[model samples]
Target: MTDGAPPRARSARLCTLARCVALAVALAGCAGTGPGTAPRPSPAPRTTSPQELCTRLVTHWAHRLLADADGGYGDYQSMGLSNGQYEILRTVLDAGRAEERINGAVSAKELIGHQIARSCTERYRGGGPTGGPWQ
Candidate 1:
């Protein structure tokens, strides 16, 4: 209580306390907020998904099979298909061969789209698989 203190002295003391409180508040706010909003790190570059990779593989093999028709019968294991995927690939190649026979190689490539999608989608719908990464 200022009791009988000089008004000017009391006013100065109050002003000093207000300033100190303001400074403390400002510093506290900064500490609570930590660094000002930092630029978020750039997102990882987009890459092909497994389904897309499957499409690419099946289509590539379909083309290769279409081209040679005989001499290109390499193992599908080397071509990066799982056992289930290899079955689909074989079916796709068979379809592609028929497509090539009927509509020509250009049109044969179109057959790869849905078959691989269906197979891969079913293959992955079970959720994150256990025994393999890309399987």
Candidate 2:
């Protein structure tokens, strides 16, 4: 099957085909690999509600903010906010009185944020919540 093509050109074509096949095989191997090396792990089957997850994240960040003075509450505000994080913060901060009283059909996100803020306030208010007389 030589249509006036030089030997060098034919060799180059063979090389290109070989390279393409090798690449295809490599990609196929990657596809068979288990989750260990998958491009993306299937998102954890959401056993809990979004509110729950958001709340947990907010609480965690808030605690971190209070503990890490260099970070501060501002950090909590943006910690894990994907897009709509304001609602969580507003609800948590304004819904209840004291950090402990944050309740009543509260979203998980709200509870988490409230807890964090409460912790910080409690620590700052003086001798450690309830005036336990500093340690």
- Which tens-of-lDDT digit does each residue in 1-135 have in candidate 1? 546879998888889999999999889766644557665587899988767676677666666766774836767678776766677787877887788789987777777666677776776566433355444
- Indicate the TM-score of model 1: 0.56
Q: Which 10-residue window in model 2 sums to the lowest lDDT? A: 126-135
TM-score of each: 0.56, 0.29
Model 1: lDDT of residue 2: 48
Clashing residue pairs for model 2: 55-108, 55-109
Alpha-carbon lDDT of model 2:
0.51
Q: Write the per-residue lDDT of candidate 2 for residues 35-116, one digit (tens) a residue.
A: 7764657877848544455555556554444344354455333555533333344344443323434444345335556554
Top-scoring candidate (TM-score): 1
Candidate 2 error regions (>4 Å): 1-46, 72-78, 86-135
> What clash count does candidate 2 reach?
2
